[model samples]
Structures are given as C-alpha cells and as structure tokens.
Target: MTGLRIIFMGTPEFACPTLRTLIERGENVVAVVTQPDRPKGRGQQTLPPPVKVLAEQHGITVLQPVKVRLPESIEQIRALEPDLIVVVAFGQILPKALLDIPKHGCINVHASLLPRYRGAAPLNWCIINGETETGVTTMMMDVGLDTGDMLLKSATPIDPDEDTQSLHDRMSQLGAELLAQTLDRLVAGELTPEKQDDALTCYAPMMKKEDGLIDWTRSAQDINNQVRGMTPWPGAFSFLDDKLLKVYKVQTASGAGNPGEVVAAGRDGIEVACGEGSLLIRELQLEGKKRMSAGDFLAGYKVPAGALLGKKDGAVGA
Candidate 1:
C-alpha cells in the first residue's frame, strides 16, 4: 500500500478530487498525465486542465501529450516506472503499450454503475432517462471502451429534485472515496475484479446542443427529466412566440388541453399541457433575458390561456 508509484492520468474538475485524495493519502504519485491546455471562454485564452492545475500546485510533474498513443508519449510514461496508472476522465484512450508499462496495469474511476451506463455522459443520461439510482464504479482498464473488469462499486439514489450539476458534484466525491478504497484493497490483494457483461451495457454518448429542444408531444414527466438533466449545459428549451425559452424548473400538473397549449398562465405558474398530463413551469429564461420565476414572467409578459407554445414550425397541432 505504501510506496506505490502512481502516475495519475485525468482532466476536468471531476478528476481533481481523485488525484488530490491519492496524494492526501500518502500515495507516491510520481507524475500527472492530463490533456493539454487549450483555449477556453469568450476571450479564447488558453487554460490548463483542472488536473494539470492541481498537479502543478503540489509540484507534481505534469504531462500533456496531444496524442497519448504515440511512441514518444509511451516512452515518457515508461521512464517513470509507475506501479499503477490511475485514470479518471482522461479524454484520450491509453494504448496497449502504456497499459502494460505500469506494474499493476491501469485502473479507471468511472462515474456510473457499469455495465448499465457507460460512456462520456453517464450522469446526464441517468437523470434524462429518469433512473432512480446510479453510482460510481472503479474498473481495471482494458482495450474496449468502459468494458473493463469491475473492481468495486458504490450506489446512491438519484434525488427527484437533483439536476445534472448537483449529481455530478456528488458523484465526483463518491468516485474519489470509492477509488481510495479500491486502491487499498488492490494493494492488500483482497480485491476481486469481475468482468463486465456486455448484454447489460448502455451507451451514453456525448450530449449535443439540439438535445435540449423540448418536444411537447412527450409526457410531462419525461420533459421534467429533460429539464433536470440538461440544466447548466445545453439547457432544456422550447419555442414561445418564435423565441427561445429555456426551462429551468417545472413540476407535473393536472390539466387537459392540446399538447403545447397553455392551459393557464398566471402568477402561480404557466400550466402547459403535454401529450400526457401537464407541466407547471416554475422558473424559466426568455431569449436575451435573465432567468426569473413564473410569477415574475407572467406579470411582465402576457402569456394568456390557450396560447400554443412550440408553434414556431407548426410542430404542435393547432
């Protein structure tokens, strides 16, 4: 357990906690391998990845290779003679050469309970699909994508009011703690790696901006999930008076009207009918405007009853 020469590979905020935990627990982290700094934000200024920033703070050597599978990249890592390569959200895939370089091979801390949810945006998809439970999984990496053998898993319930941002923060902490336990069990030879069943696997591809387009034909509950899952990113949106309207918070309501029709628009909330049930819009943002409560929006804008929302392209029935 002690003196385990670990080479950490990761990027983004999610990976920071794991790398920090490993260092805090007295692990001998020799070097940090992360994605290269790239231009970010409105100014297009280049910025270091979160992992690289954390590594630099602790004086750990940081490696940022454009192509991690290259011969030079492989050699650079091999020179470190790492006992274990701990990977978490490290954009690039590791070649077989790098995987074999580490004494104990490589291990990944993923944000899902494999093989159920596997891929780039598991946490987002879980909430979008209305899943009641999800968790983190630590696996021994292999050639296949997230098809690695599972070492340990820790489950947690998905709160009804939880948004993608909140769930992501929670899962990151959980993954860090779970990873610490996994490393300890691995060093003690008490860990049992189980092969992931491809039959139960589900792919969660990277989210697209268009994925937030609200379809009133869908059930109210489904649309509510979309609002929760897409928050703070490609936010859930619908067309209102031919302008983009982003939905921040909503709840199921009882009403009967054509899908997308505004059953009632008042200070209480905007009750919009769906293919099944209805939705009470509690919070939203109009095009080129700041987010506001339904009551404030109603007072300023006149969204009278029976107005068809999503009528931009005549998608909703008249």
Candidate 2:
C-alpha cells in the first residue's frame, strides 16, 4: 500500500535503502526505530547508524532505543498505530510484544532465501561457505531469529570473488525492491506467505574479530574466502616476522608447500602454502604500515620464499 502507515525498523547502511525507498515511494512512515549509537572505529568515536542520519535528514521521527522492551518505547510505538512494521538488518532481537504492534504484523527484509542462512551476517557466511547462489526474502516476523514465513523471495548468483560488502550493497537494493513488490501484492490480497521449513534451516552467526585470523592450514579457497569476507573490518591477518600482517586481498593458487610457507613473492601476488592448496596474496599491510600491494610488502620486507606466516604462541591470521 503506497499510502499505508508504516513503521520502519533498521540500523545499518544495508537497511538505509529500504527506508529511503519507502519514503521515496510516498509511504506513510509514522516512525523509524533503530539501534542506539555506539562507539566505533579506531578511536572508538560514537557513531549514529547511516539509517538514523538519513531519517533525521528527511525529518522522519527517529527512535534509538537501547532496548525496545521498555514500557514507554512500547507505548510510543502503539501511539503511532501503524498498518505495518518493516524491519531490515535492525541489529536487535525484536520482542514478541513489539512484533504484534502493527495491525498487519511486522515483516523483515532478510538477505538470504529463508530456512537457509537464517541468522545474522547471512551475506558473509554465504560466500564463506562457497554458495554459488543466494537471494533476498521478505518474511513475516516471529519471535524466533529470522525463522519467519516467507512472503516473497528473489534470487541472484554469487560471483567467485564476491565479498560481503559488495553483496550486502546489492541485497540492500534488492530488499527494497522486494518489499515494494510484496507490499503491492499484500494490499491487493494476493500475497502468499509460505512457511519456512525449519528442518532445512542453517545459521549465520555474527562474525567476530577473532574469526578474521587466517588459518593457513585450511584450504586455499577457504582462506581466500575468509580474507575477502571479513574485509574493511576485522581483516584477515597473519604474523609476518613477529609482527601482525593483515591480508586485504588474495586468490587461490595451484602450488603447494608447508602450510603458511611463502612460496613466491612478486608484484602480482604473494603465493603462500596451505594444507592441500596455496593462496596468492594480492594486497597486505604491516602492523604500522599503510596498505599496499603484497609485492610492495615483499620489496620492503624480506618475506622471502619459504618464510613461515603463522607461528605457535603467535597471532594466527584469520
């Protein structure tokens, strides 16, 4: 319903597109609920979510609740009397009370085809697990995490080197499109929500900084996926010459040697050994150095052939 009163719930950059799309389509967004600002970045500076900033720019009422369970927050939402509540990467587990506030109930724009990859960080896990195809789903929200009934789903193929950041950007736009179409069908009483088969559910737990450490013993492809999937935050790292060396980009290779051994070094990429396969590092950065090509790193530092990457009692590169 283009003119339907809606409450949009989201927090990250991925969610911003859906919120923007609703406003652009002239939907009656009564309020926007997002997570509270938290300290972020190297300096731990407090930062508001992109969605919050965008909402403020549009003069939309913004609510940053540390927790939505509080009575006043509940009352505030009830006051709006919204027809539907839309959630997208809201970064919080919504309570049952809030899920039932909207007359048509709350719906979520999830990044994966539901019943598979049903948890936080679906986009990253999909590539990490080598899935060739993934997509977006609009679902009826339940108390369980992403275990909702699917209203509409749209699929897309994943490129061999597609990372989480790029995939997220694409899904954000796709989710907005799906939500719009889902809403149209819903208003026309043509929407059919299919219950997700719980037996087929897979989880995508949140990624942690420790998860980015490179495990050289793993397959070259797995390490490569981890490196790219964790990019731009909690980057995959390995110890080089007793110092932390972060790997920003990498590719699989055919060579093999002792796991973590530097097989070759050049401007193209740094070839490193794995248990069964090997990986060529394209980009890297030393602990206190600017990001540069792996070849540049090779030129400055002696990461010569046969040098081991990770040592015991040393930091493990994810």
Query: Which candidate has the top score in lDDT?
Result: 1
**Candidate 1's TM-score:** 0.96
Q: Give all candidates' CA lDDT scores.
A: 0.91, 0.88
RMSD of 1: 1.8
lDDT of 1: 0.91
The C-alpha stretches of model 2 lying farther than 4 A from their native spots are 311-318
lDDT of 2 by residue, 52-121 (tens): 9999999999998888888888888989999899999998888888888888999899999988999988
Model 1 ranges with Cα > 4 A deviation? none
Residue 28 local lDDT, model 1: 93
Q: What is the TM-score of each candidate against the true structure?
A: 0.96, 0.96
Write down the worst ten-residue block by lDDT for model 1.
Answer: 309-318
Clashing pairs in 1: none
Which candidate has the top score in TM-score? 2
